[model samples]
Target: MAGPLQRVLMRSAASAMHRAKASEWHYGPGFDPQKAAAQYEALTMLVLASGAEIEWLTDADDGLADSVFTHDPSLMTDHGAIILAMGKALRRAEPGLHEAAYRRMEVPILGRIEHPGQVEGGDCVWVDSRTLAVGRGVRT
Candidate 1:
């Protein structure tokens, strides 16, 4: 989570976010798909301007509303990515998408958190080069 930005894996908002059912996804009433897609585009442009290589995951509408939040599906370490298991039932399919992306990019996978063991990338923090602090909470 530190150092220079080299590559980032992201999914396009138009793929799933734009077609997400706000209510089912627990999105607030004010959630607007069009605005979300526009914002995502703007953010993508900014990331591009920063000169970081962007690795896109997919453009297909997989009905994974929060799939755009790519940080939670996997953990990237110096060795490789650790595919995580989602705590949310609706998000169970997300990790596979990330694993596929890694395979496509030829990125090695160090490990995976299988069923009955849940670990979300968002719930982890790097303490140093070799230490990782993982928080246990509702979203973890």
Candidate 2:
């Protein structure tokens, strides 16, 4: 049997898809805003269907096109959550937004990475209870 997902974070793609230019992200072709919205709704429904309580980040409609991928801004552990710093300049605001949401949800924040150090949550993978492998590259 699959383990229960206690909580999950998600962002709506409506504003991001409708307001931002596709050229900003080099989305060259086949980018449909309507389709994107449909897919996003389907994906959110799937997450809910899996028995996870979702925390939708509704206030993050600041035209950050990549905001829908919430996993990149924070890392969750049994002890608490770590708000990460984005390596990409355009994505910098994401961490702060995530921090506010986590605070509202009463999720403990362990710490945050400051300037000169960069890590995206997507770049870190848990190997076991105590080990985490962090990727070192442009994004992390």
Candidate 3:
């Protein structure tokens, strides 16, 4: 059975979420900023939500040592790998690190995309063997 306090908490949480608008709620239930993050961190909600894993600006490895434009491989093949040069300065070093790793593995270089056209790693997705899409996510 649901307790009275649990019912009240549900109502309060619902009200807070409703008032903030569906897409506009960065803060969580209680409508308080300080504790808002805590409600959002609850396990029940996160498990049900769609996760977007972005290693970008990874606190540990920002991929700076690699290159400013590094991205995941197009395809991880047994023979070797393909390194892509990103269009943006924000990712200039990532590809180089990937290149070094491939070098250690004794893989061959497949060629890269040069400047003028900018691409963000966030905008990349592997569609299939014949297709790889690169979208400029933060394009102005």
Candidate 4:
């Protein structure tokens, strides 16, 4: 028994896997682009699970350590979002930029994290619709 909706969803999943396999960038001995591309595909799985069809203001700039200075699109909830202050020095800019994107998304900012405390997207896990388990990374 296969409904059209279920069939479409299944197709989307299979296509995603195919694209991940087709990605040719590979990380090498010193540093590898292929490996990096593969990692990016893995991380995109998380983004795909958001459940909310939201838009993104991608920085696409890789100068920062995390390259996400303030792209906290995760804060876009039905109620509001709490702006996260990142712990990484290079990505401290991420929160402010996140604020701007949230503004464009028209989502309300319920609160924010102060300095001396930082959040990294790579260390965050959205376990459920309303729950998240975020970890800290080693500071340089």
Candidate 5:
């Protein structure tokens, strides 16, 4: 059997789609809020089905449209979470919001990536307990 999931972090599509056009990550012609909401609901159901305790972030009016992809702001590890400093200038506000949520949940914070070092959580992958592979690219 699969090991039990400890926790998961997710932001609502309602918050994300409200300002989709302003998002730097979306290149599509236009965003349909209804479709986004449906997709988000489906994804949440899947996470719940996997038996992970989900933490939903409802504060969406921060003008961070890309917030729905929570994987970009922080990376979780066995030791703790590393709050990333996103390479995208528009996304700089994300990590602080995630940090507050983590603090509320009592999740330990290992450290944070400072200004000079730009690291998006989406660019880093944990190969194993002692190995982490990070991509060095425009968005990393």
Candidate 6:
């Protein structure tokens, strides 16, 4: 899915990412929370400068270190958002967070991939408005 950034859903790094357990999250020894936060701030500023509207997800220390990756939890479409089920076991709760954000933002829910049908937004490639190609693998 390639398009101009008009609106985006983002979670700040102030929560889980700030206190991410490097071993659990598979982050390398080079991982630094402060640097990550600074980079996030820079990116946020860029997104704002681009005139895009950002809908932020609430930050909380829920031990979901990977929660800051909002894109993988849901897929946005012209109609509504498709709540995705994560392939990664640690990210299972992430979809619920996105769902809650959508409800708060008044964004409609098109459908969701159930327990047995796991799908990650990153593995989905939209060829057009209606054409979608889904890849299946370890991370799908």
Residues 15-133 of candidate 2 have per-residue lDDT tens digits of 66666677776566777777887899899899899988899786446878788889899888888889899998888988988899989999999999888888998888787768888
List the global CA lDDT of all models.
0.90, 0.83, 0.40, 0.46, 0.82, 0.86
Task: Evaluate model 4: give its lDDT.
Answer: 0.46
Model 4 agreement with the true structure over 1-140: per-residue lDDT tens digits:
11111100111222222223222222123443345446655545655664424344443443332332223323433476677766545456656656776687677899876767555554665666567676656621
lDDT of 6 by residue, 12-97 (tens): 88666877878778889999988888888898899999999999887877777788777789999998999999989989999999
Cand. 3 Cα-lDDT: 0.40
Measured with C-alpha atoms, the lDDT of residue 137 in candidate 3 is 55
Cα lDDT tens digits, model 3, 1-140, are: 11111100011122223233322432233355324435534632543353422122222333232221233322233344555545435445655555665575566766555555444444665565455565655521
Best by TM-score: 1
Cα-based TM-score, every candidate: 0.95, 0.90, 0.39, 0.50, 0.89, 0.93
Q: What's model 1's overall lDDT?
A: 0.90
Instruction: Check candidate 5 and list the clashing pairs.
Output: none
Specify the poorest-scoring 10-residue window by lDDT in model 3: 1-10
In model 4, state the lDDT of residue 16: 24
Encode model 1's per-residue lDDT on 1-140: one tens digit a residue. 66677899998887678778888999989899999989999999998998999999888777898999999999999989999999999999999999999999999999999889898988998888788999989867
Task: Give the CA lDDT, 0 to 100, for residue 125 in model 3.
Answer: 57
Instruction: Output the TM-score of candidate 6.
Output: 0.93
lDDT of 1 at 57: 87
lDDT score at residue 53, model 5, on the 0-100 scale: 90
Residue 53 of model 1, lDDT score: 97
